[model samples]
Target chain A: MRPEIVMLALAVGACTWAFRALPFRFDLTGLTPEGWLSRLLAATGPAAIAALCAVSVLPLVKGAAPPAPLGAGLGAVIGLWVWRRSVVLATLGGALAYGAVFAL
Target chain B: MGEARAQFAQGMVAGLPVVLGYFPIAFSFGVAASRAGFSAAETTAFSLIVYSGAAQFLAVALVAAGTPLLVAGFTLVAMGVRHLAYGPALMKHAGQGRTRRAWIWAFGLTDEVFGVALGDLARGRRFSEAFMAGLGLAAYLAWVSGSWAGALAGGGALAAYPAVEAGLGFMLPALFLALLLSILSRRQMPVILIAAGVTLGVTLAVSATAGILAGMLAGALTGALRRATA
Candidate 1:
């Protein structure tokens, strides 16, 4: 088995166990609108996601230019998601945009 | 039908929205994974075992970029830290008397399931263990099956039309962008910008894993500081 798979299994398994066994609790009733910890946790998702997007789309490899189709597809996805609020439509729209650009 | 069976049926009904939302996204993950050169089995393992939509997609990108497994795994753990809160909040409504079953069910507590469970609890509904289980099962099946179908289709599409392969490469970034845009808020703008800037700078200077980790830390810390002072 690949080391990555093994690591994935271990990490996921540990998280699963932690979910069941951890002593953390958030009292929603007591949660203030300005609770920093809760807000921090919420912020993590977007931050991580955006970071991932940057890594995926940005040209990390030396001398490699950014993929034009990807940029166009990302624009299509953002447009469709804003207009439709539907991930399905956005993804499909992006895929089609990418295909069109690549083919051209 | 037994009470459990009835509750299960109701749970499945409630999960319909999640099923609809998850299928296409999961399909996109499959296609993205395939384009990243993951085997079908690996893709399926991701769906079945990790079962985290964002983490799975991120893992694929990281792996494709040659990130170390431990670093990628840790990144996934960080991505999943938010789920830690879900189990406790849900234990009261869904796990009540069954400890072991609840523990097992907790493994399936994706954001969608947590949202549905929370909604039910808010409405003062008596959600049963069986109901939660049913909801999880339905969503799980949809995700796994959707991934399988997507992988098969992706393979066929790439084989039949090589030009489509380049198109598929864009799927992950586009999906991430959509998710980010959907959740963007005025307050989050700074965090997102910081994360993006850090990610771009670090990835160019260091490794992808380090860049992601640095970006997440920087963004989260900034958000926390802002919230603390506010």
Candidate 2:
């Protein structure tokens, strides 16, 4: 990357680090010690993982006909069900399935 | 100081993937901006100033279409309104920061970045300013790097790779689906479907952006109604 780009990258990296590193503790102070906040944070990783899979279906229908949504939908269901283990698989399955539907 | 550094590190680790993702997107943005007749410096400035992905895409597309700057500016401001929510939601988590500082950081918030930051903050994990900063910094670097890379490669050549292009385009929608699924329950499916239907209908009648906003509103309203009825 060019020097300017490199510098910009460094700045972004720095900003992310700062946000992640804020000093306040997650205060689960009451009866609900593991408060809503804690639960929400915990959900972040799984949510991201699921999103990675869910997004795969989107691309499959982009340039194709509206009926292509059928293939995309089926692919997402199957992909999420069978390849539930892998985010990449989930994504790939959706796209490939949609393509297959269009081809046929 | 020590606490800030530790939090920053945590943020860095958490934000690594986001940073990686931003690089190519930014690179593409840079290329697009440059092709639309912006200088390299101007391209970088856009990223530095109005860094939201969708808005950036719209800006470049509008400029390329020869839309006047005033129109582009208004469109961007309208599109960027969604980001305003980040400030109120995140302010308490950032500790005793001034409104100005919060607003500045709020401008930098993206869906992914906010999702990651807010989730962590809500959990009461001891905030590390450094970790948060590190994560943001990583994403920022990736964007700048990606933009520069895109600028160098030229738009025509980049457009030729259809698969990569399509895959990238799909990323946001896929992410959205995943989010919807995460919150989806058997009881909530109907409400979501209704919202989605309404959104698409509205979008067809108005604009795609309007559809997105309408869908979100409809979805939220349905959820609230269900809660009240239940």
Best model per DockQ: 1
Alpha carbon deviation, residue B229, candidate 1 (Å): 4.8
Residue range B81-185, candidate 1, lDDT tens digits: 656667667766654355446656666777677777788888997868788888888888888988887877765565667556655556666666766776688
Error of 2 at B229 (Å): 10
Model 1 CA deviation exceeding 4 Å by range = A16-40, A59-72, A83-89, A100-104, B31-37, B84-102, B113-129, B149-157, B162-167, B227-230
How far is B7's C-alpha from truth in model 2 (Å)?
A: 3.0
For candidate 1, give the lDDT of residue B67: 80
Model 2 has an lDDT value of: 0.51
Candidate 2 lDDT, B1-230, residue by residue in tens: 87667766777788776775567557656666776776676577657655666556555655565654554454444334334334445656655543333323444456567767777777776544455556666666676677667766665654665555444444334434534444456655655565567556665577444554455445444544443222
Q: Candidate 2 lDDT, tens digit per residue, A5-61? A: 344334433433233223122222221324444333323322222222222233344
* Among all candidates shown, the one with the greatest TM-score: 1
